[model samples]
Target chain A: MSTIVKVGMADLKVVEYPDALTTLGLGSCVGICLYDSTTRVTGMAHIMLPSSKAIRKNENVAKFADTAITELIQIMESKGAKKTRFIAKIAGGAQMFAFSSQNDSMKIGERNAEAVRAILKELNIPIKADDTGGNFGRTIEFYSESGKLLIKTAGKGIKEI
Target chain B: MGIEFDRMNNDIIIDVLREIGNIGAGNAATSLAKMIDKKIDMKVPVVKLVDFDEVPEMLGGPENIVCGIFFKLEGDITGSIMFVLDQKSAINLVDLLMPRDNAEFDEFTISALKEIGNILSGSYIASLSGLTNLQIKISVPALAIDMAGAILSVPAIHFGQMSDNVLIIQNEFIEVLEAKSVDGYFFLIPDLDSYEVLLGSLGVTL
Candidate 1:
């Protein structure tokens, strides 16, 4: 049986081939899916913030893009996945609501996506599929066997990447 | 730091929180009752320290579809407030407010619902300001129709930047319209820094 593991907000999980990883209802939070097709090892992190350095409490490693990506890669490596074979697919990071005068905090979704993009570039991990921004929430599922990510929305319908 | 966590251990402190919720929610319920011209019954607010993981489950798990109205509380206090209604209650409310056959959430329906949220949240915040003697201002209401977890992540991420624990005041309003039942929820979350200013104004300083 291919078990599907759930990754909560500010949380993460790693699974082997034939297994899947999912995260529900992402708003202004980014879901990072890292997969090594050769080993069929996959990892997902539900990151809420762009950087942990800006915040005081730094206990939750999976809560920030900077920390979560690094941590996720390490965990995937431990599961017999090589860093060079890593392919990234990201979803969520949506502006769930619109406001007239945009505040620094209100643009978190855009910020999170940007941060993830930059960090992945620095790490030399090429993103296979990218779906970020807009005013909506997303529930994403990542299949480890095929390294495919599925994105579902309330009204926008579903798409695979 | 927010209100002295040490005090939360006291039963008397919990009662004070309850009183605060009653005053604000009571006013909100009355205004809603008048708007719909229906009898509305409100239960005592449930106040607790909720973790980020438990937030989505507050309204029938994270994936449960809900109509959530978000407001950024500004001025003397800074935090976030959300008024949530399940799919059934959302449809019932739209029908009650606009009174039409086969009401769809067209532009007009959404606008009406946004205004309703604005008015209700304004009243709730105003009541708190009156009780605490604080200058609380609310931002324009933002409405989202999606899964509860997604809707709630906005506030959770906002407050999550500071602490994992968020203080929540969950208020339920029941509308008595015969056998069919309808309900709505108000979730009040004060920013950690605002707690000192909020609690101090009510003369409950430690």
Candidate 2:
């Protein structure tokens, strides 16, 4: 039986091959999945903010893109996954509500996606695929065995990357 | 550092705010009753400082589909208010209001529902401002039909950036019309900085 680990909002989890990690109802939040096919180790983070430096709250490391990606990578490596073998697939950075004035805070979805990409680049991880930027919410499931990220939405149906 | 400083620990302040929320919720129920043309009863407003992750469970689970109308509170107190209804209740409401033969949430139905949310939230805020003597203004209301977790995440992200715990005033509205039941929720999230202003105006000081 493949164990399914559920991640909450602003939370993260890791699983091995034949197992999966999933996070549900990602609106402006980004679900970054890092996997190493060799070791079949997978790590997923549901990041709500782009950077922790911009805010006074620094307690939750998994809640920010800057900290989440680095922490996920470290955890995957500790699980016998090689750093160089890591690749990324992300989903669910959506502008859930459209506002007339383009405030920086209101653009959290775009910012989160950008921040994840920037950090992944800095860490030398290639982003294989992403299904993002629409005005709908998504629930993502990441399978370590196949290195596939499955995204499910309401009207948009589902996709695998 | 926001209101999470030592002030939030004061029981007196929390009780005062809870009372304020009760009054506001009462006003909202009245307005909603008028709009729906049915007697709307609201449960006692719950005032609590909840974690960001746990908030989605307030309505349902994170993945539960819901219809939300969002309005940003501006001026003296800045925050957001959302009137959320589950999918079935939302369609039921539209059916009650428009009585279309087919159950479809078209653009017109959505716009109508948004207006209903606008009225309820507006009255809720108006009552709060009136009782507290603060000048509270509201932005245009926006509607989103999505998962409960997704719709609430907008304000959660904005508020969670400052503090892990968000102050929420949640009220449940229910009405049984013709033996059919309908229910929804009203979520009031006051900005971190606004708590101090609100308490100060209410004669409570940290």
Candidate 3:
């Protein structure tokens, strides 16, 4: 059995064979889990924001949802995971802040979620299942061997994805 | 009609707010640093004093805003203070607080934001109280959808026509492991009686 590889926010980890990739405490942020069931290759990233432009250019680029997703995909593909065969499962994107204004930038949580969907669609990678959006937070675990996804939400029960 | 006070120029207000923001943010940074056993470096806060209509532009968009309320006291004087941070900053903060865990960014992280808010609000208020030698109580931070409207409405209950005067300060937080950007705003709403008291305290003759 492969050991579980845990990834933190702004970080990513990839492993081959029987290993489980996991990330926890997703709030307004997005966690993208990519798994190649045939090869048992799994990768996960906990991205904090949707865009990198809002932050300093030289900063941690992996922390942003957009760059992180692309990087995760490239890294996984480099490890012999095929892009066409990879299935994506995502979680997080809570409206942690309740104050609504007329502006769009502040709705970062929503924007992050929207951006993830848009990016995934453009890549032609089908999102097999997703748990996103709300006032609460979530934790996600992805199993590479069987492509089993376990999701735990705040004040809510665990669910299989 | 409520009496209109002379508007403070943006540059002057911003400068004053930047100084105050540094002090308040410094308190928060110290608290977090002690908790995580890491050194935090924060840039000098950027302050902006703008009309209510201009807040949207300054903040960059309309979404949920989280606020922490605190009271500051200085030598028998008391002031109500509030801190506001953007959603992105909130997420980044949660990530920094719980770095070892492999949790996705979700409600757990948002809940984590409240914890940071509590620390920041509590510590800053405590610092202000310590400096001022007065007692200050803070209300439980309420996460609301419309922050500006909520703040204006709350002050109206205690004071009439009080939303017009607001002070805002923005800052960035940086540490060796990560960096997060955030902003805070202080709204000064005084009732007719409190207004008189404030003016009196400032030694202004009505």
Candidate 4:
């Protein structure tokens, strides 16, 4: 039995067993998980920022959403996980900002979620299920053994990830 | 409109920064209080204005530090502010928001820190707008390492350093389980023309 592995914001976790990897509290930040059901390999990343342009190169590159997702895919493939079999599941992109005016440009939560969706689409990886968008935060867990996902949000009840 | 600090001396600036900290931290504390249903006692906020060179010394070696930068736009002009929090304070703050039964640092704790950063930055900008009566808009908070030399070396990286005004506010938050101290630095980096405009808005003469 693989124990629960918790990942923080701006961090990444790669495990051979999908049962071990889990991520939580996705607000404006994004939680992306790459898993291969055949090989039972899994990788998760919690990205706080969208891009790494402003950050230094020597810094931890896995903290950004774009770079982290790419890195996670590479790591999963290295563990004998096939790209064709890999599927992506994402969560946590809430419009947490309570601005009076609704400006499209200012919707970072929506933008982040959209960015992940677009990137996954470009990579040809299908997103199996996603629980994104709203005014509340979320906690997500992934099980590599069964490729099972668990999701929990305040006042929203718990569901399969 | 270069602000000649006659009325806003170093001491006065510190006082103002303290007041700002009180208001900003108070807002965050209220939210945390509501989340955990526990009251927290925050120390009197300490404020200082230091040169760019002095930033490293104040942060005490700069290891395990996290920085968040946000740009605030007021009409045509924009100003940037950075918030720096130490590792211990960051973890403690998260623990306060989401107390775990296991007493271990978990994913929930890290997420809590990010959320805390979000709340602090949001409340700080909102309080600033309320205080200055300026329609300020803030970007989402982005996290960074608090390497002092690296942060100050790149002068024009995020915000230009045309103006020599920097405000540092130190706050201590005390709860029943843990106590933590964190610093919030506000750098008013404005171009020559924008600096003048900002000063004029603040009722300071050039």
Q: Put down candidate 2 lDDT per residue, B1-206, tens digits, no spaces.
A: 57553344546756886888899889987987787688776788888767877877876788888898888888898877778888777777777666777787778878888887788789988998998899998788888989888887887787676666656777766775653444666667677688888888888877
Q: lDDT of all predictions, in order shown?
A: 0.83, 0.82, 0.59, 0.60
Best by DockQ: 2
Clashing pairs in 2: none
TM-score of each: 0.90, 0.91, 0.50, 0.53
Per-residue alpha-carbon lDDT of candidate 4 for residues B1-206, written as tens digits (9 for 90 to 100) = 23333333545544555666678767756665666667677666666555433554565532223343434444534655555555555666666666556544456655565566666666766776677666666665544433333233222122211223345666566675454433444443433345445444556444
lDDT of the structure predicted as candidate 4: 0.60
Best by TM-score: 2
lDDT of 3 by residue, A63-144 (tens): 6777787888888888998988988888876654344232342355577778888888989988998888775556678888
Q: Please write out the lDDT profile of model 1 over residues A43-115, one tens digit for every residue.
A: 9999999999977777889999999999999999998999999999998888887888887778889999999
Per-residue lDDT of candidate 3, residues B1-206 (tens digit): 32233444334434443554667778877887887677788777665544433443444432234343433222343334455555555556666777646645476865676667667777766664554344555545545333333222232212212323345556566766554434544443333334344444334444
State residue B86's C-alpha deviation in candidate 1, in Å: 1.2
Kindly report the fnat of each predicted structure, to 2 decimals. 0.76, 0.76, 0.03, 0.00
Query: After superposition, which runs of candidate 4 have C-alpha atoms over 4 Å from their true positions?
Result: A53-58, B1-42, B46-206
Worst 10 residues of 3 chain A by lDDT: A97-106
In what order do the candidates fall by TM-score, top score first?
2, 1, 4, 3
Model 2 lDDT per residue over A45-87, tens place: 9999999896765788988999888888888888899979999
- TM-score, prediction 2: 0.91
Please list the Cα RMSD from the true structure of every candidate, rounded to 1 decimal place.
2.7, 2.4, 15.8, 12.3
Query: Distance from true position, residue B50, model 1, in Å?
Result: 2.6
TM-score of 1: 0.90
